[model samples]
Target: MTQQVPDKLVIAISSRALFDLDESHHIYETDGLAAYCAHQRAHESVPLAPGVAFPLVQKLLALNTPDPQRPRVEVILVSRNSADTGLRIFNSIRHSGLDIVRAAFTGGASSQRYLAAFGAHLFLSADAGDVRAAIDAGYAAATILPSSGQGEGAGGQLRIAFDGDAVLFSDVSERIYKQRGLAAFAANELAEAGTPLPGGPFKEFLAALHRIQADFPQDAAPLRTALITARSAPSHERAIRTLRAWNINIDEALFLGGMPKGPFLKAFGADIFFDDQQGHCDSARVHVATGHVPYGVANEAPASLPFSVVSQ
Candidate 1:
């Protein structure tokens, strides 16, 4: 009989997101792939430093310690490097003691194509193109942003923060807001408060997480989730009612209205934060490990909109 893939929360991540490869990446960009391959080979024995998503991966792996035989989470490394060039990354993984045995080294080919093959619930990568392709392919994916500070969840709790519209829920409401402005959006939300919003890209991923959380005691659960959005008051009611209808429990909900999300996300000690808007992601990445979910109205090409520095 063949061994079965465990029914768990599967996450597919890139080598750059797992470890700090900025120096090596710079070599690849400036000198070319040949120099990059040679550099990696030369530094093969050196352990790579942790990147923005390191803490999140560490805490996620810790969830399995409760039941080694039956782990709740699985992380797969997906990279564009060839198997020969990937030995350094593998060695670093060993040095860091990360239990990431599975990998797909595409040898410069597109690695996002293998995400479904690994049963990945989420894909995180520093490569924006790969992330965009994965999202377009209907997988829950995000472009990992560079972070100045490390994540704050040092207690082993996996704290995940998500933007409400275009992330947890569908972009329908967001499209309305973008087309008709705030007042009309609020009115629409008010009228549809009782109706549940359509599920977005991350909906299935959140449901999977909820299932895992249900398996553990409330106090013992290793994960916590939050809905961090700009929606507030009247508009917020619809989001709340929508989650209730779905029977999903959000550990925390922060409706910041139009305020910047960076400060709030920092206070929350989030291991990772996801948002559809680049502006929100720009702010959040400074304080927490942030991922850009390039979807919905805001991300659409702005043909009629006037050019502005902020918009750029």
Candidate 2:
């Protein structure tokens, strides 16, 4: 008799994201999605980039033992294709015996657009904004890296860094910092020092991670997280107090005020860094993995850098 688990895990995936193989591996004569699905059904393992979807999924499933009380792991597949395609993929999911709860066809122009709105406990896709939205919505998300099909860099832990203002903490402080500049932002944070700042996009995921850590206290995996922001000294003080108040454990935090983050991120070995400023992402990407977050005060928007902001 399997021990029943009371709660269920909801994972929202794109029909294509679940495919077994890297569709772009061989020359494709058919449409990308169709060829991709065909390859998966043929048992051709797709080459997922390091620190990407398949690795994360594999890790999660490994954690899922038979919990008689907990509902079976459920995967919700979303796609922008016709119902026929969705059904075909759904059938494939069923045949594979993967824990699939449902399938939805969003029929949007881009699959990324649809996946962002398909809320689940986790979202896997390459869209930066969609990934940001999913994180904002309290879902764990990972982007499919284009290169290095498998395995993380040797010895180094997979490092993920988040910007404080909009990506990790509420944009309220960020907007103040942007509109009236740093001095005003510091004053406001000092005022709200005792009060908890509203959680930002990554709050839910951070909480989930804490829960996971609590469950598996002995096994501290190589996953590390950090907060890199441009708020130094007095300003950084309140943010620190806020996180402490929330009981979120961030492995590393840098209070860089008006300093380029690329070098610091390089030092931290950040696999990926998320920030609302295009310039920050631009500079950071040269030395480390970087993503541009598109939210918060419109005026504080960092100028577009030479790097690609959107994930392919």
- TM-score to true structure, per model: 0.95, 0.63
**In model 2, which regions exceed 4 Å deviation?**
1-77, 82-119, 127-158, 287-291, 298-312
Tens digit of lDDT per residue, candidate 2, span 32-64? Answer: 666744554454232333223434444445445
For model 1, how does the per-residue alpha-carbon lDDT over 4-60 read when each residue is reduced to its tens digit? 466788999999999999999999999999999999999999999998888889998
Give the lDDT of residue 36 in candidate 2.
48
lDDT minimum window of 10 residues, candidate 2? 303-312
- In terms of lDDT, the best-performing candidate is 1
True-structure Cα RMSD, model 2: 6.8
Error of 2 at 210 (Å): 1.1
Clashes of 1: 0
